[model samples]
Target chain A: MTDFLYNYLHVYLFVALFMLFCGIVGVVYRRTLIGMLVSLELIMNGAGLNLVALNRFVSPENAYGTAFTLIIMGIAAAEAAVALGIIILIFRKYRHIEGGDLREMRD
Target chain B: MNFAEIIFLFIIAVTMGGAATAVLAGSVVYAIMGLVVTMFGVAALYVYLNSPFVALMQILIYVGAVTVLIAFAVMLVGPLYRRPKEWTTAGKFGAALGVALVSLLLFVRFVTETFPRAGAPSFEMTTKDIGRLFFDDLVLPFELISLLIVVAILGAIMLALFARGNK
Candidate 1:
């Protein structure tokens, strides 16, 4: 069992894919801004997982995967900060953060 | 199952369970808590993949910083009456679940068939090597990312202050 896991790349790939799917579903199904943000983080993580897995199982010589994943983490942190800031601002303006109520541009 | 496999399985379960909770939980606070679990589990998976440095950063940045930021956002938004807003109808829920399942099955089949089963040779990637790569090969992007963070911090503060002023 250990060998099957540590020796196989597909396992990690499958897990990452599952995570991405979950994130997509969450994004579509969620109504609130914060909930959607959380799902977006999940999707980012899934991508990071896939990158590291491919790095480990496809190209072990270079530290490219790890570095790339670090870059992704940085980007995700910035995204979360900006997103939360926007959410806070929206809440202050509208007094609520529901998706349905954010239809100001609708004619 | 050997010790390592058991641990791997456990980590996967935790990761998936946490993600499920984060997405499915009714309360936003509970969803953030579940996100914490999922972040830690992903960090653990990084360790298993032989990148302990990334794992540590994952824990530090994601579990420590990002989760705290989210929690603060939740607190700032004030108390919320747990409303069944996300999945208001059973039909919507069922449709989303059906799409997720179908996509998952297709992805699994494509990956298993296309990707070669023979794993690449393993190698130890020390923190020093990662640092060297960051400084040497990825210096430009690294510096740019740092700049991005600085800008983001300033923007967040400005936006918050502006919002307060408008009130």
Candidate 2:
């Protein structure tokens, strides 16, 4: 446990896997669009951490991995904006944002 | 693990717990708060990786912008705090089994693949190196990414406007 924790890679990998687990659970259990969006962000952040970790430890000079992580953040910001707008629209039209209850498009 | 490793491990544990709580908590607001803690942990990890610039950016972009946006969305949308009466058994079981199995597999892979590649640690790839790379080999993509961010912002605004007008 001591050796594992001291090493930088261990912390990085642990965080990634743990975040991924949280994301999966959030996806499975969350009923609101906002909650789901939060989960999605968790997933993206996990991936971003992985990129930074790999870049730092294994391939420091390349810098592509870190750059990609930033790009992912950019994408996530845009995604959140658009998703929130859609969620609002859904709420305005249907009066609720519950994933289970908002089954209007089931056809 | 050494004393330093132990301390870091403690931090990592807290981070994971916070992340789990953020996603699985009953209230949407608490979940978002948990996400803030998780973001802090990720930033810490960035620091551990020898990139204070990325760590600062992580905090600024994720903790500042993203968390604020999520909070705003939660406030504007109703039912965010209203707890559902019940979750189906299937939902609970599936999520539990899913996380357990995935974590288990990942642990195995982690143990197996980690030992062989314990290469020597290199220089502290400091902020200067990052800036150099940003201007040198990575110039084009860096500019393109900014453009993509702009497009995403515009598209989001357009969608919101269109949805409002239709309603």
Task: Report fnat for all candidates as fractions from 0 to 1.
Answer: 0.72, 0.46
Quick one: best TM-score, which candidate? Answer: 1
**Cα DockQ of the candidate 2 complex:** 0.50
* lDDT per residue as tens, model 1, B2-57: 78888999999999999998889888888888889998989998988999989999
DockQ of every model listed? 0.70, 0.50
Runs in model 2 deviating more than 4 A are A1-4, A102-107, B1-3, B79-92, B103-107, B114-120
TM-score of chain B of 2: 0.83
**Per-candidate local distance difference test:** 0.86, 0.76
Model 2 lDDT, residue A21, Cα: 77
Candidate 2, pairs of clashing residues: A2-B1, A3-B1
Residues B1-167, candidate 2: write the lDDT tens digits. 46756667776887898888877677787888899998888888777676788889889888999889889887777753464632335757486667756875877597458634454366376667767878898888778878877887888788678777776
The lowest-lDDT stretch of 10 consecutive residues in candidate 1 chain A is: A98-107
Worst 10 residues of 2 chain A by lDDT: A1-10
